[model samples]
Target: MSEATEVKKVGQTPVSNSEAVKVANTSGTTPVDTSKSTDKKKKKKKKRTNISKIENYFPDGVYPEGEWMNYDQDFNLARTTDEEKRYLTRDLENQDHWNEVRKAAEIHRRVRKNVEGKIHPGMRLTEIADLIENTTRKYTDAEDLTKMDDPTSRGIGFPTGLSINDIAAHFTPNKGDKTILRYEDVMKVDFGVQVNGNIIDSAWTVSFDPQYDNLLTAVREATNTGIKEAGIDVRLTDIGEAIQEVMESYEVEINGDTYGVKPCRNLCGHNIGPWRIHGGKSVPIVKNGDITKMEEGEHFAIETFGSTGSGYVTTEGECSHYAVQDYDYDAPSLPSANKLLETINKSFGTLPFCRRYLDKIGEDEHEYALNYLVKQGYVQDYPPLVDIPGSYTAQYEHTILLHPNKKEIVSRGDDY
Candidate 1:
């Protein structure tokens, strides 16, 4: 209903000419002292680069500059909203429930990780994807819920996000679609859910392109770099620039041509609070100076969506439903709220949710509870909006907390 919003940025303003010039001078390359020995000059230049100064990009402090997120209160409001919507939707006809959704998500993760880890090589994108989908049948209820002729109820698995090389992201398999995985393919898999009244959405990518390993590596490293640099005092834009700088340093080579990997300007990691998908304050992973800092108690998905084309990206001119955000709070509750909440509480609690629980909500208020659960961080899902063009892109996401002890990664499913 929000008009299928594209990736948006905030906390940015026009820079004065003087300011731009000063910033440019500081970031510009240093003059080479060719008169000195080549080896000595290289060492001297390295010392001058002063990687240590990178830490100065943030404000002096350990905590964020704003009020910390009240997860309990905020999530409760979000859950209530989600439940109201679920009450109006049709119920999933399949019996696999949330288990099936979880199975699919995990299976995809395994296959993607396997590819990233070199467990399988020369596998095409679709081959790897098929293996993941078929593997889910081994554990999930093997019913096609989205089929019209089938008597099975329409389930939440009707949609999925599959992004392959040059394709930023957001693709689903129709009744009989097939796409194969190929060597040097960078693959990204993102998914969502509607269990009970909760939702969970996430994504990650793998690269098989040999020439662009360093580019992929740089982007991967940037995820960690941005996370480490994130804090109460760090500007969000700084995170973007840092990632941009790292990726730019590496020449992105694909199909025998050298290119540059740009941070998908339109896509960045966002706040992950209860059912209000795309929470607040987009933390840019590519930027031009303006910044936003992380605060304690604020749960965020420090996701990295990178590309091998120009940093600027335009949408595909078409929009698809990925995850529905719950915004209605004053709506009346349906009979299924109680049952849905109960199921959600039992299955999800404070942990992330999956789509299988939608069936338990009794079809009436399933979507309503779905929104509520997402607010509770139960039914979490990643929005499918990435830059286009090029053959490959990579994504690495992790849910984290800005705590006093340290920045804690809540989703410990993967390292990157």
Candidate 2:
């Protein structure tokens, strides 16, 4: 989760420094006369559009009084052209849906920017998780989980994943866990934000040492390659081949040993649906024979992982990520398990949750109930997806919305 210095509007040019100064002067401060300024040549400022004012899109702020719908007439009017409007109204069928998706993506971008450069070697993993989750709660206005039953409730889509070193994904700090980041560790920060179940899943790798720069670059470029290759009717296999070509081409050397970056063959990005993180289709990192074509009006998380060891991951360590199974099944016999299931349905629905979230909502001493639900096939437990032990891994991900007219990289930022 990296970010740019200033937030830019979608399909709009960035505000220049002079325009920024003009904005800063509106706060009851005397404006500086640019006529007396040093520069001889004056550049004309581009006309600002309503779309550039992100605040207009969220007129009532991040939290709405009722449903999280944008009632602003300018919301639809802000489109750059009539074709863009048709893409939203006719093709997508709902302008507010895409608006919510963009809002959720913006929340992710802002939170990631706030937390960047704050993670250091000595911070506890729990501290880092809390920092990220709390910031997300503040931005989404869903701080109170007990009151998250609103139709357009906005909050974390899943637990904050702080997977480190060989662990590629699905690892979060459980309650009382005391793991600390070290100077040489390569940590992957993965998180999601959801507005009315439109989840924006994005991630990036961080390392204090410079030796892993190539590793980070390979995975990041691979992710961007996938994004660039993805389109309305693009075959999934071609995108994977393009990703692998960029990712596997780079090699990293550490301690007099060179390791060719390998795409994690077992892990692949997937399509995302409402309240569903992994929606049916898989976007592979390496070239495969799967002939899935990315459809218009579909959302996807195009993530890539580069590993120094085997280009595969296995489930290991403590399980923290959990989601209610989508299939229908018989209810558990245990009353506690039934209660836990009820809670999960009420608070998270089909979205993922962690043990730490359960504790946050005052579910104390409920391990047995949680385990019972999992054993009864009422829930799915996701353990840490790790590569070979002692081998380093890096990951980069971005969420894409495939519109009929154009593909929007919703989770994109300056710092990939």
Quote each prediction's TM-score. Answer: 0.51, 0.80
Best by lDDT: 2
Compute the lDDT for candidate 1: 0.50
Give each prediction's root-mean-square deviation over alpha carbons: 24.4, 14.9
Instruction: Assess the local accuracy of residue 41 in candidate 2 as a C-alpha lDDT between 0 and 100.
Output: 59
Worst 10 residues of 2 by lDDT: 63-72
**229-327, model 1: which lDDT tens digit per residue?**
666556788777777677666666666787776677777877654443356778887775665566544556677766776555555523323243334
Taking all chains together, the TM-score of candidate 2 against the true structure is 0.80
Clash number for candidate 2 = 0
The lDDT of model 2 is 0.84
By summed lDDT, the worst window of 10 consecutive residues in model 1 runs over 49-58
RMSD of 2: 14.9
The per-residue C-alpha lDDT of model 1 at residue 231 equals 61
